[model samples]
Target: MTEETAPQDGPDGPDGPDGPDGRAARPDREGGAQAARPAGPAGDPGDAGARRGGRWRRPGPQQVPQPHPAAKGMWRGDAGGPFAQMTVMPGRMSVRLRLTLLYGLLFFMAGALLLFVMSVLMANILGNVKVIGFGISDAEAAELQRQFVEQTMRQLVGRSLLALGGVGVITLVLGWFVADRALSPLQRVTTTARRLSESTLHERIALEGPDDEIKELADTFDAMLERLGQAFDTQRRFVANASHELRTPLAINRTLLEVALGDPEASDDLRAVGRTLLATNARHERLIEGLLLLARSERELTARTPVDLAEVAATVLEHSARREHDNDVAVHPELTPGTALGDPVLLEHLVSNLVENAIKHNAEDGGELWIRTGMLEGYATVQVENTGPVVPAYEVERLFEPFRRLNADRVESAKGAGLGLSIVRSVVLAHRGAVYAVPRPGGGLIVTVRLPPGQPAA
Candidate 1:
């Protein structure tokens, strides 16, 4: 380091760490000035101990000269040389910015065009005034008329040019505003999308107002994110459920086979083990099939015709009434007339899965189930609530995912594959609907489904 003058003020400020003035800027070790210097390849000098409060006193009239590292990069210098010995950072001109320059150029052109037009108009007026003011004899009358005709033509041309210039300016202004308005929604969607992660999938980009292009764009964007969130949720649940379900059966079969080969067992014991394995295998198959169906529903993009959601709910009740051998739930319906436009197959699946889920999770000792359907806004909604054990609030969202089951208490048999809720969610999505499973107030679980209604096409 080059030798330089140390501050004449002893470097340490008047205030100390515990002083009334507050902590000083001087290094604790040096008891003098605290200066940070750029390090060299050789090594940096020993740094003084940190000041208690990291305050640096403002240097007085005297200035301290410090060395700054010379910038070394492709853009370090311009044709004129380095700017005050500081490197010029390279910057890029984006397409939008470059296009903006054309705007400036057109602005200049419009000015030029107006000036040229005004000049010609003024010249013609001056010429006509001169012709009318100057005296004319019989011999010069024809020449005067010729001059008048030429000036008249020039005046007409100037007027036309003025009109064209005005049109161009109007066009440019309108074009700029329209283009900006068109892309505004896209900008909002982009910003929200960047902030989105697995944790914030619930946030939506719902554009309000009339069904214009920007509104439509926002709607489409929200739908895509919605689907993605669902897919991720389903995948997570499927993996967990499949692992749990498969492990149970494998463990049982291994134990039974080991017992039969290693030790003598009664005929009844062996048969019972075989039956358990068979039942587990059946559940495994159902889980796999459910997973496949959910995957297919998520992948579909085409919209389906609108049907009556209330009717679909009623059909599902029929299947639920006889699904389980011993599901003794008392089902009641509060049906209302409504229409819904969506995939019929998916709609049916949504209703069936929800009601079946409601009944299955309830106790067989006469659990109560309430199925209600009615017009909700421009669509139809069905809610199936049943009496059962209380479900925790935090786990409500996860239960809709494939292979997700809440078994923290471990009270019920954990052997069944956890794909029912996942399927319900997937089918609901295919119908462009929403599904939520909540702990029913006063009793059981509530599965709510909402679908858009279809109106007659114009």
Candidate 2:
């Protein structure tokens, strides 16, 4: 038997028209009348009417209110912002004053309320009494009644006010004591915070009291400090490990490159490449050394030695004399005894880097390098100036940042890894010293460093 295939109910069905559901469709939308859809509710989604109709929803959580900017500054007692300079004057409303005023006001209000009740009762009792039994004229009886009521009220009010005044004085004295007690915990918190620093991180608030909000705050602060101490310790360990791990390989590479370059039978091309590689390797070593030194110098000094700033400057100049001569830079040293307490090696590095930087970036011909050291205002001071490209006053600050240089184009030989000033800053900070640089009027820089005076040399 011949099998007749039934028409599939698809877009092109036996019904002749195709639709999205594969059934007979209406005429093409552009050519035919379309069915109208029922209209939706009137207002836009977030409009007031929609909200009133319960069509718009609100967030499940109510947002917490933030303190006003003015209120924040007022609470912080900042130098500016609303209420920062406000006082309850005519009279100053200190915490104690405010508490005292509150106590007095409440006592006065209670006394006034009691007096009002007594006055009302007296008036009611007098008002209800009849005057016929006294045998006096109506006018006279009325006059007598009036005088009696007036005298009674005057005495009542006067005595009640006097008692209120006396109570108010007593309440004020008590309020002062109460206010002081209430603020004692806050005072403790302030004292603890003032005494805490990086060096004293082991100390804690240890607020011994009930589990109140202030106690909780103190505990949180202590926990934060503990975490900070741990983080700092970890960082120191990481820097030490990295210095050891990275320096060993760099030293080995330098040794290998040097041995290879030393071969007499090596080809010229090979020798040239070896020399370049060795130079690059040496630059990497200097960079690593600079980073390690910078990290070490940022930490608190554990041991200090008496180091003479003038001697350090003189030694650095002596070492750099050959470079200065080759670069056509004249070294002018004005050294005086300026002793500082710090790590001797780090101080030496600080001096050498400053001097080297001055030489490196000096004028191409007849550059003048001046290094001066002496005591300035009880500080061991070292000042270095060089004749080089002009430096802008604004860019002086950025020079102390790691890998930051005046010219964006970085030539390693010219800039020397851009860490000289940064390392100097770190060392200065480690020794509790200050370093600042100012651009000279012509074309150069005058960098000054002042270190705290050290103990007398033994």
Candidate 3:
């Protein structure tokens, strides 16, 4: 017997030695093998290939495909698809209103269903009643009975519908009241949370009610506040104690350095070393002071009085005049009446830091500085603009962080410790105000501060 060879199936299974579509593979002009498909009814080779392979094919220039009726509202950019449209609500409907409406709708539906059932039963019962008439034809009596049943049903349905409408209105009103009462506890929680901050962490919800979900949430919030208050208190005490302990040693060192430098017979090298040590000591003292001020500003102000921002800015400018002249920076002030409620010392510090920062970071020669203080939109406003090297917009916000400066390598900086802007921000926040900075157009920065307006001090 002759050796039998089993035929191997093509990749698509049990097909002849051809392409997946059962057509012989032919080499194209590009020397690539492709299936040779017969033309379809439209006599287009591409169409035939698409049909044979069961795949989507782009329409030719002469052919345009019509959209199906079902796809009329689908994939539209302006109107959006059905699923996207379904997610859009008609307007701003609060949860409480939605619940109330839902309750009223359910009641209305139940009432309508009950009316329908009663009407049907009444009609069946009236239809079964035998018509009893004296001295009248049975057919006439039956017609009269039919008319009476129709009239009675009409009156009953009308009255029932009217009653349902009145009851639905009352139901909506009651539902609204109930929803408001139900959500009142949540509203309290929200209000307390909004009013509480780092300074007011001692405030608690202390909501008194049955141990339900809302009460549980309020209790949890109160517990969080208690823990936060403890943490903040501990932090404040540590900072105060550390600063006090450090001040004594620094003060002693400064006194010793001054005495050593004042010695008449001291060698030149010894004198130079003493002066350097004194400068270093002064810098350390300034750093400590900055830290203490920062801690104080981050806490709630215990005392507040009307402080004129324009007067504060004028004082700062007077003190900064020598520094500005030495740096070859020009100061332009536009001070008008702008009073705010805050601690005078902290507000002065805020203005001083801003003015010093502006002068220190100014251009080498003839840098211009502008300081404006006035009432703006019912808020006391102070704005400072200066000329200096270009500051990137992305780095503006980081300047408010403690120990952060425009230059990454700040250790060797002769400028005061990198706490100027940080202190300013703290003071602004302590006063419940806002401060922001933006990069100047050509090169430099513009810092603006807005505080709650206060009455002039009498």
Query: Which candidate order results from sorting by TM-score in descending order?
Result: 3, 2, 1
Instruction: Tell me the lDDT of candidate 3.
Output: 0.68
Per-model TM against the reference:
0.45, 0.62, 0.71
Best by lDDT: 3
- lDDT tens string, model 1, 308-332? 6667878887766666652567887
- What TM-score does candidate 3 reach? 0.71
**TM-score of model 2 (CA atoms):** 0.62
Worst 10 residues of 3 by lDDT: 22-31
Candidate with the larger lDDT of 1 and 3:
3
CA lDDT of every candidate: 0.54, 0.64, 0.68
- Residue by residue across 1-458, what tens digits does model 3's lDDT show? 11111122234321112111111111100101111222222433323333433111112223222221211222111112111122223477888999999999999999999999999999999898888989999999999999999999999999999999999999999999999999999989977775566767878889998999999999999998999899888988898798879999999999998888889999999998988888888888888898899988887676678899889999988877756344478887767667877899999999998988898788987898877676543456677878898887677777888888887636433677888898987787667565656666567777767565568889
What's the count of clashing pairs in each model shown? 4, 2, 0
Query: Residue 90 deviation, candidate 3, in Å?
Result: 14
Query: Model 1 residue 316 lDDT?
Result: 80
Measured with C-alpha atoms, the lDDT of residue 69 in candidate 3 is 20
